[model samples]
Target: MAKTFEVNKTIKEINERIKNGKAVVVNAEEMVEIVRSKGKVEAAKEIDVVTTGTFSPMCSSGMLFNIGQEPPTMKTSQVWLNNVPCYAGIAAADAYIGATEPAEDDPLNKVYPGRFAYGGGHVIEDLIAGKTVRLKAKAYGTDCYPRKEIEKDITLKDLPNAVMLNPRNCYQNYNCAVNMTSRTIYTYMGPLKANQRNANFATAGQLSPLFNDPYLKTIGLGTRIFLAGSKGYVIGAGTQHVKNPARNERGIPLGGSGTLMIKGDLEGMDPRYFRGLSFQGYGCTASVGIGIPIPILNEEMAWYTGVSDADIQMPVKDYGYDYPNGIGRALAHVTFEELKSGEITVNGKVIPTVPLTSHVISLEIADKLKSWIQKGDFLLTEPVEEIEST
Candidate 1:
C-alpha cells in the first residue's frame, strides 16, 4: 500500500525542515517534480508570460503535486492572465525598472521667444585709413525674406524696412554717403541721381528701410555702412534727406543677387557675429579687403559687441539734432561759446539729418507708414497742424 500522509502535516514538516537548513534538497525525481511544478506556478503568476490560467490558491494545490500527470488548465486562463497587472508586477518585482512617463508640468516643452543678442565688435570702431571690412547680407526667418525683385521708381520709403541690399552703383564703385538722419555713414550705390525726385534712390528692388522708425533715434554718430561685394565704410553723417540721389554706373541690377547692405557702427562687427555661413562670407571678404586676420565669428568677438545698460546714459543738454521741426536749425546755430559754457556736452555735437533709430520712432506712426515706405514707391506727406500762438 502507498504511504498515507496527512497533507497539511506533511507540508508543515517539510517547510520547517527547509527553513532550518537554510536550503532545500530533494531526491532527483522529487526535485524535478518540484521544479516543474514551481515553473508552472511562476509562469501562471507572470501576467505577461502565462495567458491560459486562473491562479487561485485552490487550483494551485492540485497543480503542485500533479507535476508528471497531464496538467489541468484554468477555465478563464486567457481572460485572467490578460487582466494581470504586468506593469505593476515589473515595477514591484524588478529593481531595474524606472518610471517611463514624464511629469505633466515638465519644463522641457516650454519655448522662448526670439531676440537679437548684441555682443562685442557689433559697432564700427575706428575705420583705419585703408583697412577693409567685408559685410555679408543674409535673411533670417520668414519676416526678413526679400519678396519682390528690383523695381523702378521705388524710393527708399517703398522698400521693406528689413529687406536691405547693396546699391548696384554703390557696390560697384565703392562710393558711400553719410546718412544725416541716423548719424551713421552710408556708402552710396552710385552718384546721386540728378533728376530723381528722392535724394536717396535704391536700385529698383534693392533698397530696404530702417528696421524700425522709432528706433532710428538712438543710432547716434560714428556708425558704419557696408555694401555687399565691396568694402565697409564709415558713417560721416547719419541718415538724411539729400537734394539728390547718390549714383553709380547703372551696372546689373542688384535684385536677386543675394548681396547685402550693412548700416551700423562698424565697431559693432566684433569677430563673434561671424559664426555661420553668412558671417563667414563677410569675414572672408573683410580679410581680403583689410588684412585684419580673424575668424569669421568667435565667442570672444560676441562678448565684445554686446552693450551694457550702464553704458547708455542720457546726455545732459539737448542738441536739436533729433527733433523734426526746429531741432536742425537750433543745432546749427548753437554758438560755440554757448555750447562750451553749457553744463552738458549734448549741445556741442552737430546733428546730421537722419531717420531716427527704430527704437526712438513712434510705433503708431511707424506701423502706419512702414508698408508704404517698404514698398519703396509711396510718397509720404506730413499733415500741417494749425496752431494759435499764445
Candidate 2:
C-alpha cells in the first residue's frame, strides 16, 4: 500500500501539520512496533515524523580548548591537562585532546589492557563539570610569544567556548562482538567474556540515524539535532566514513557506514549526557548522546522511518584478538527486536546479548525530542548538501 510522494511537497505538508500543532510524531523505537502490527501504509499515514537517538562511548571525540595567557603570555608547545597530553599543535594558545590519548609516562598498555582512571575524556568531563584542571606546557623562548613554560590550574569557565567538535561519534551500523580468547578482554565494546561467552553491541537499534536513513537523504548539512541535550547540526561526513558500504536487502549497511561530524557549544550541553567511560583492558572514551528527527516528507520517507527492528541486520564478529579483521563467522540475521530481547541465536546457540549503548536513555531522548518538535520549538530541515559517497 505505498504511493508516490515528493520530498518537497511532503515537507510542506509536514510543516503545515506543525503549524497546526497536530503532526503525528513518534520515537523510532515505537515506530517499529506500529509498523509491524498496523502495516507500513497505515502506520506511515499515522506518524508524520520519527526521532532517532544514540548514546555510546565514541573514541573519536575530543575538546577544543583555548588556554588563556596568564600575564606570561607563553607559547604553549607542550601541554597536558590532568597529566593527559593536549595537542598544542593547533596554535599558540589552542589545543585538542583526543579521547583515547594515554598518559605520556604510561603510553604503552603496561597497565595491562589499558588505563581508564584518567585521560583526555576524564579531563573534558571534569572541565565541563566546572572543575579545575592542572595545566603544564613548555615552549621555546620567542620575543613575540615570550614565555616558554606555564604551570597553573585552569577551568573551562575561563574559556567559555570549550566546544565539543568531534570528527566522529555515531555509526550507521555496528558489529555484535564476542571474544574467542581464553581470557576476558575489556574493550571499547565493554568486557567480552572469553570464548564467545558474551556478545556486546552498541547503537540504538532501529533508532540509529544512518539505519533510519540509509541513503543520508534527510540528514545533511544544517540538519538540526539533539546534541547532549542542546541543539546542534550535522557539519559533514565524519572521518573514516565509508559511505558506500555494502548493504543488505533491507538497504541497511551490513557493517558500519555513514558517519556525522557534529558541533555544539560545550557550555550549553548537559553534563549528565556527556560522560567519560573506561574499559579495563582498553582505554577511555567519551559517551556522547545525540538525536535526530526525520520528517515524513512522503510515504517513502514515512516508510523509511517506519522500518522495524526485525528488518535491520548487522554482522557478528570475533573480538578475541584481531578485531575488524576478525571473521564474521555468522550474521545475526535477527531484527532489532530479537537483538534487544537480551538474547539471540548465533551458530545455532542462544547467546545472551549485552548493549554497550543504553536503549532506555536513548528512548527517553527520543521522547524528549518529539515533545520539542510537537510544541513548535523544534523544526525539521532538509540537508543543504548531500554527503558525498566515496
Candidate 3:
C-alpha cells in the first residue's frame, strides 16, 4: 500500500530543516555530468574527477569546486549549492533599487522657448459719424480658392478656365476690419477697380475710410491696417501699399489734352468697393485683394482662406505675418551654423551646409520641436558625474 502523509506536518518538517541548514532529498532522478582522470591511487585532490550536479556532498564531487575560483559570498537569507552562483536575491535587490531611484536620462525634462502669433488688417470707407456720402464703385474680379490647392497638379492649360468666372461674385471679395481704437467691425469690399471711366472713381491716392467716412486718412504712406472676417481673408498685413497710374478722368493725361484715353484695363488693379451691400462668396475673397499681382501675397491669401481667428490663434503664432524679423534672422544664423556642422536633418537627409536662415529650418520644424518640449519628451539630463584619474 502507498504511504499517506499530512500536508501540514510535511510543511512544518521542511521549515524546521531549512532553519537548521538541512534539506531532504528524495529518490535520485538522474546523473547530470561526469569527468574522469587517467590515474587511480593518487590523492583525491590530484585525481581530477569532474561532475555536474545541483548539489555535492564534498567539494571534490563537483568539477566547478576544484577550478581554483573563489566562491561567491552566500548570505544566510541567500541560497546556492556547490560552486555555482544563484542570482535570485541579487535580482530582487536590484529591482528594489530601481523602483526607488529616479531616472537619470528621462526624455521628458527639457525647457523650450516661448512663442506667440499675431494678425491684423484694414478697411477703406467714405462715411464719418452718420452721413451718407455718395459711394460709387465697381468690383471686377473674385477668387475663392487656396493657392496651394490651385497650384497643385496644375498645368498651364488649366489657367484660363480656373480664373474666378463671376466678376460680381461677392463670395470672392469681402472683408472686415477692426478699428483697434473702437473695437468695431469695419466692413470693406474687394474686386480690382474696374471702371476708371466712371467720373466718381477717385485717384489711387485718395484717402477714404470705409465705415467711418469723411475721415480722409492718407492712402499711400504704408499705413498698417487690420482687416478681419469669417472667410479667412483678414488683412492689411504682409504687404500694405497701393499704386496709381498717372491719369485723369477719361483715362487721359492732365496736361496733354489730346492724349488718347487708354481704353484698356490697367495691368494691376484694386478690388472695387460697394456700400451697404452684403454679397455672397467664399470668405477667401473677402480676406484677399482680388487683383494683387504679387504671387506671394496671393499665396498668403489662399493659404489663410477658410481659417478662423480662433483656429489661427491656436497655432504657435497668432499671426504668421507678424514674425519678428530680428529674432528670425538670428535663428536663421544659428540654424545655418548647425547645418554646416551636420546638426540638423531633413527628410532623413542632412541639409547641405549653406547660408543659415529661419526659412531654412522651416516653421514646421521649429513648431515640432516646441511641441515635443511641451509634451515633456526631449529633456535635458543632469550633468554627468566625473571620474577621478588614478
Best candidate according to TM-score? 2
Prediction 3 global C-alpha lDDT: 0.17
> Which digits, one per residue and each the tens of the lDDT, describe model 1 over residues 64-84?
000011112111101100011
Candidate 3, residues 55-109: lDDT per residue as tens digits?
0000000000111111221122221211112122322111001101112222222
How close is every model to the real structure, measured as TM-score?
A: 0.15, 0.89, 0.12
Tell me the TM-score of model 1. 0.15
lDDT of 1 at 262: 27
Best by lDDT: 2
Alpha-carbon local distance difference test for all models: 0.19, 0.79, 0.17
Candidate 3: residue 293 lDDT (0-100): 7
Question: What tens-digit string does per-residue lDDT give for candidate 2 at 62-153?
Answer: 88878877776777888898888989888888988888886666544555546556677777778778889888889996887889888888
Which stretch of 10 consecutive residues in model 3 shows the poorest summed lDDT?
55-64
Model 3 CA lDDT for position 65: 10
Better model by TM-score: candidate 2 vs candidate 3: 2
Off-target runs (Cα >4 Å) in candidate 2 are 1-3, 6-20, 37-46, 104-113, 321-333
